[model samples]
Target: MAGMLNIGVSGLNAAQAQLNTTSHNITNAGTVGYHRQTVGQAARPPLFTGAGFFGQGTDVTSVTRSYNQFLENQVLQADNRRAQYGAYSAQIGQINNLLADSTTGLSPALANFFAGVQEVASNPTSVAARQSLISNGQALASRFQSLNTRLEEVRQGVEGGIVQTVESINTYAKAIAEMNQRIVVAQAGGAGAPANDLLDQRDQLLAELNKLVQITVVDETDSGKANGAVSVFIGSGQPLVLRGTVSQFQVIPSAADPQRGAISLTAPGGNTIEIAESLLSGGELGGLLEFRLVSLDAAQNELGLIALGITETFNAQHKLGVDLEGVLGKDFFKPIAPTVVPAVAGVSTSITDVSEVRAKDYRVLVSGGSVRLFAGDEELASLALAPAPAWPATLTGGGIAVSLPGAASIPADGLLIQPTRNAARNIAVGISDPREIAAGGPVSVTSPLTNQGTGKVANIDIRDIAGMDGSGDGVPDFSAFALGFDGTGPALTVPAGFTIERLKMDAATGEWVTDGSYPSGGSSTTYTPSADSSGVQFRVTGPGGYTFDFRFSGTPESGDAFSFGPSVAGVADNRNAVALGALQTTKVLGADASGRPTATFQSLYAQTVTTVGNKTREVQVNEAAQESLLDQATSARDSVSGVNLDEEAANLVRYQLAYQASARVMTVAQRLFDELISIGR
Candidate 1:
């Protein structure tokens, strides 16, 4: 009878534990990260008897939550990727819209400005036309400044977002560390039993942290048993949490670019290590870093490139012309110079060739007595400081020339060179007066009607107007200079105040080679022509120090000649304005692999727009795909670990029935014990 009663009581206890677990699951069914718990049971040891061993009641061994490590990890990875793409898509869309909008974009402004130039070219003497040109130029500059301002705002927003994300990650790290401590204590007290609820909480915190930054989690164990603590690492194994201790994330200015922010990990020992942006491959923080590097910086630099092109090329051509006042043209737009960070003393950088400039920032590193120039990670040029780095030295690359003064020393930290990064922001119209516009060429070429030869002069390039001014006067010294090509050779006739250089085209390379030069009043007046020389090129310098280049094309009969002289003052000579207007179609932005000019100002801006639009579309598609994957992964994980209300209800009924049956057995045992006592009486 005693044995029967002990078995019944043990069965009742097991059923009650099952009912309790099922009720717990039913109550917490809506809880996030909650895994359904179950009571683990095993039959107690059987009693030994003469005939056979009798089965004993079940013993409740342990209660465990349903969980799958692999499924949960899948969900985490998918979620992290989705978050990264979503963030990227959001940020890049802004740039796409800003650059692609016709009204707000650089395209309309560029077209309008060029149209104004054409109008001025058509009526070179009209003050209204010139004033309109100035107004349009100012408007164009304003548009550039506006675009740059907006991009800067976006950059600042990204920096702020990064800072906020790091703070949130730190917060999650601290909470996870606290949960780890609690879980370890709880599990220890439970004597090897897992702290199921505390583990869920820690995982929830981890999921939140993963949204901010990509992370890797490792199970912390003691003697091959899980202690319910995890080690969390980010950005190439930098620890965020380690065995109940939390590390911190910090936002710091980048060493190379102070304008940007960088991530750092503060270990428990108080040592902080900077994390490379490339190492972070997923999550919102990763998205921000990537957007800044790949999209934002490139967009800004390209915009600045256009601004620089306008400033440099326009100013150069403008200086070659004569204004309404009959003086040489000055800079049409304010000059832009390269920006160097941690300014090296006596070192200055300038854009020497606008056509060769690329939209990239450079770094100058001084190591082992040598200065190396890098565009991103690619080393472009290196100069050894063998002669103590001579002053007035130049290191030229990427279309820019860096001028270093004598005795200049580069900082140990190096220099960050941004050639066009701030050009748009700093670009402005240089001249305010309409009369200051240079719309006339300083020198003119004329072919007399009497010449019978098919030869004609074309493509006059003004080298230096100041070079033609041989006298001490500001005005160019006009002269009667004539070049006649006879069947034997070419002869030059000038009034002793000119220098002439003769050049012939190379047959193989098609480049002109200088044959000879005649200084002022040189006795040599004739040159023999090569049989294969199709055309001849000459550079003429006048007495007032003005220089110009002209090309003679086609076959010339003997006595055929072209005359050179200064342009008439206060005349409607639209030659320079025509040249300036031609800049609208000039290919001056960058070069291709074949060394061909790749884009004009308008096309370059269009390319920028297209690139940003494509990136935005790609990120959107990726975000959608990752979202679907996240959903699938979550469903798979939830199917194994999530609670079911109907299942718990069914379990409730089954455990209730088992409990009633166990009670009935106990009642039967009690009655049998009473009957035995009755028989003894």
Candidate 2:
């Protein structure tokens, strides 16, 4: 009876443990990250008798939670990726809408500005038209500034997000470290038994941290046994949490670009390292970094490029015309210069060729007596400085000219060069008065009435007005000159400061053949007129960089003559305005490999809009796909580790029945004991 009672007591304890485990599971079924617990049991040692050993009742051994490491890791990875794509899509969508909107975009402003130019060209003397043009110019500049402001706001928002995300990551790391301590202590006190609840809490914290930034987890072992501690690493093995010690994360300005924010990690040993943006991938932080690097920067730079193109090209052409007062036209728009960071004393930068400018930032590195200029990671130009620093030395590359003064010393940390980054923000109209608009060409041409030939000067195109000012005066140095054609050929009586080149068309090939060149001081070129000689073309050049192309068509008699001179008080002439209006369709924005313009202003802006729209669409699709993947992965993980209410309820009934059976056995044992005692009495 004693042996039976002991066996019945052992069975009762085992059944009680199973019921407790089942109750615990049922109670915590709604808890996040909670795994169902199970009771482990083993039969006690059997008593050895003469015959076969009698079996002893069961003993409760251990309780463990159902968990799978592989499935959990898969869930984490999928969640991180989904978060990254979602963040990226949210940020880029704003830029897409901003650029693609017809009313708010640069395209409409550009078209309206050019339409105003056309108005001015049509009515050169109308003050209303000129004032409207000025208003349109101002509006265009304001549009550019406003667009840049919006982009800057987005950038600031990204910076704020980065700061918040880093703070959350650090907070999670500290909490995880504390949880590690609790789990280790609890497991140790439980005599090698796993602390299931504390382990779940730590895993929950890890999953939360992974949403902010992707991380890798490693189980910490003591003497080859898992001590319920883990080490967490992020951004290519940078330790974030090590057992009981937690590292910290900080947001700092980037070394390459101070305006941008970067992530830094501070180890427990007092070492801090800035993580490269490219190394950090997945999660919200990665998405922010990537969006800033690829989308935000590119959009701003491309907008600035368009602004620069408008300013440079328009100003160049405007300066070649005469205003209402017959004075030379000043700049139509203020020029934008390259921006250099860490302002070096006696160093200046300028844009020399707008066509060659690319939407990129540059770096100037000076080390070992050599100065190297880099556009991104590629070296553009390298020069060795002289033992004595050269004064007024110019380094030209990527359409920008960097000038260094004699006293200019190379900065040890190098300089950052941004050619067009600020152009959109700073662009403005240079002229305010409507009458200051240059609408008349500087030079005019006419045919002498005494000419007997049907030959007449059909067109005179200004090649370079700056080249025409040979007398060091601000005015173009054009003089009265006549080109008379005799029956044998055409002869030019050139002025003292003028040089001319003559060309004739070959009938067979239909190509112009250079006849001869006449130098200054009245030189003559002989060419016999032929029936197949289409016409005569003359390229006349004057001092002070002024040049023009003159084409003469039709047969010229012996005394046919044409003259050229500067236009005086030519307010009614709209030749320059016509030329300026042509800029709308001109391919003057981007250049090909051979340095030919490939895109008009409107076309380039359209391309920018298209690129942003495509990127936004791509990110949205990726986000949706990642969402699907995350759902699948979560389901897979939950299938193994998640609690099922129905299953837990069924377990409760089964464990309860076992407990009753054990109670009945114990009751029978007690009754038998009573019988024995009664017999003994």
Candidate 3:
């Protein structure tokens, strides 16, 4: 009876303990950073007999919880990557919103301004139209300034985030180190199993750590004990954190020039060091860094590229024409400064005064009714156009020389230089029908070259426009033969007294055509027969040559004096705009009123507007796409690793049952012993 009672009691006790464990799990289901636990049971030693052994009641071996190291590691890594992209996408999206947004967006204001310009281009002499353009121009500049301020705010936020993350990492590391100390002591005290709670604490810390950076973990047992020491690291053998009695770690910041920031780690001296929680690979901090610092920064740079392109191209074109203000060619758009610093030695320190050599300093001279392009020196010329090249060129020669217009001789200090006749235009060359170049219009060389003697020289150099035989004059009349040449063949011939230079070509779309007569054919015109042939009549080439085909450029209304010649037009002219409808006086706003368009109110509403609205739309579309991609990636990551209530509830029930069973077993065993004693009496 006693033996039977004992066996039944043991069974009952085990069942009750299980119930308790499940209850505990349930109670803590909503706890943050909690893991489920269960009691692991095993049979007691069997009684040895001559024939066989009798089974003994079960006993708890060690309280074990469900865990998969490999799976958890996967979760950490994915989370890290997700965080990075999320951060980058979020910050960049904000910038996109500001720059290309629709409602209360800067883009609308910019478009309005451009529309005003179109109006001005159409009616250059109208004071009302000109004033409206001036108003719009001020508004556009204001948008830029506002956007810049907002970007600065974002940057400050990132910096603050970094500091906060660092502090959190330090706290986690200290806690881990303390846990290690306790764990080691428990093992040494002859504890049968590891300190489970402490282990749970450590594991939790490790998971948190992975949010910042990827890490590796190691488990080592005491010489004779099942419970062991834990060590964490970044890779194969790089110590991040170590635990002897407690955990100890270090925080190291990034040292690279581009990413000069700090990161935290555990156990600087340990064989297996681990990245801290704030610096780990799986959390929001990582995402923020990626989105705000890395990705957004890159996007901003691209925006600068587009802005700079428009500014430089327009300025170049504006330089070619004389504005009504009596100023030959004031820079229409200011040049964009390089957002990224160059890799040159002593660049930051040596170049202290940027204003002295800013783009505004370089002046263009349209003297003698001909274009004379010049640069101060070879170095300045290279610097001025550095933004022109997509990739950096290797410096084979120390510096290259440039050929400039109005050059009696090269400046003593090498201050005035021009693109060598052999130098190519850096722009991508376009080739199509000959009608692309307008009759008697200016043409631009498509390719640019810093160094000379490349095979890609423009067929018609602006400097040589005077010598083109447009009239088939035998003397090669230097003045009447203003012609334009694409680096490719089928150059356009400019007739004398014609202000229209080259025919306009689309940059994004490869389409070309001339603006005036000879839409597809031309009559033969003779200047002077070559001394060898008297009856020679110069017939212009057709289909493939001087035949005119109409192509649209920036539209101008009647009374607009703007005209491009075949010899001076190039891909850069695509950015030009003119006003046609409204007229007003020009008014320059003061610095304080730069960003406030409504302030210092000026009216020019009825002015004609011809804007480059098409281009702005492209920017808006790109920003939207990038934002959507980032959102999707972030959601997927959360699903994989984020905490779930249902799963936690299930674990809670399981652990509660185990705890109840353990207690029940103890109580029933006592009752069984009492029953045996009473029966024996």
Q: Which candidate is the best by TM-score?
A: 2
Q: Native-vs-model 3 lDDT?
A: 0.41
Candidate 2, superposed: residue stretches over 4 Å from native: 367-369, 386-389, 406-408, 467-477, 484-496, 502-538
Candidate lDDT values, in order: 0.84, 0.82, 0.41
Query: What tens-digit string does per-residue lDDT give for candidate 2 at 275-394?
Result: 999988899999998999899999999999999999999998888888887777889998888888868888899888898888888788876676777777767676787675556677
The local lDDT score (0 to 100) that residue 155 gets in candidate 1 is 94
Name the regions of candidate 3 deviating beyond 4 angstroms.
1-23, 33-35, 46-58, 74-89, 104-106, 221-227, 235-238, 244-282, 333-681
Task: Report the candidate with higher TM-score, 2 versus 3.
Answer: 2
Tell me each candidate's TM-score. 0.92, 0.92, 0.52
Tens-digit lDDT string for candidate 3 (247-275): 33343443221233445343434443334
Model 1 C-alpha lDDT per residue in residues 1-681, reported as the tens digit of each score: 888898899999999999999999999899988988999999989998998899788899999999999999899999999999888888899899998998999999999999999998999999999999999999999999999999999999999999999899989998998898898889889997988888888889999889888899999888898788899998888888898788888899888888789988888898998888999879999999999999999999999999999999889999888888877788999999889997767889888777777888888887677778877786767788896655667788778887766424666667889988999999999999998899998877788999886776776778777655556455566565776655654554444666667666666434455564532234124433443236557666666576777766665677777787777778897888998998898887786554456678988998899999999999999999999999999899879888888888899999999999999989999999999999999
Give the least accurate 10-residue stretch of model 3, judged by summed lDDT: 603-612
The deviation in Å at residue 594 for candidate 2 is: 2.0
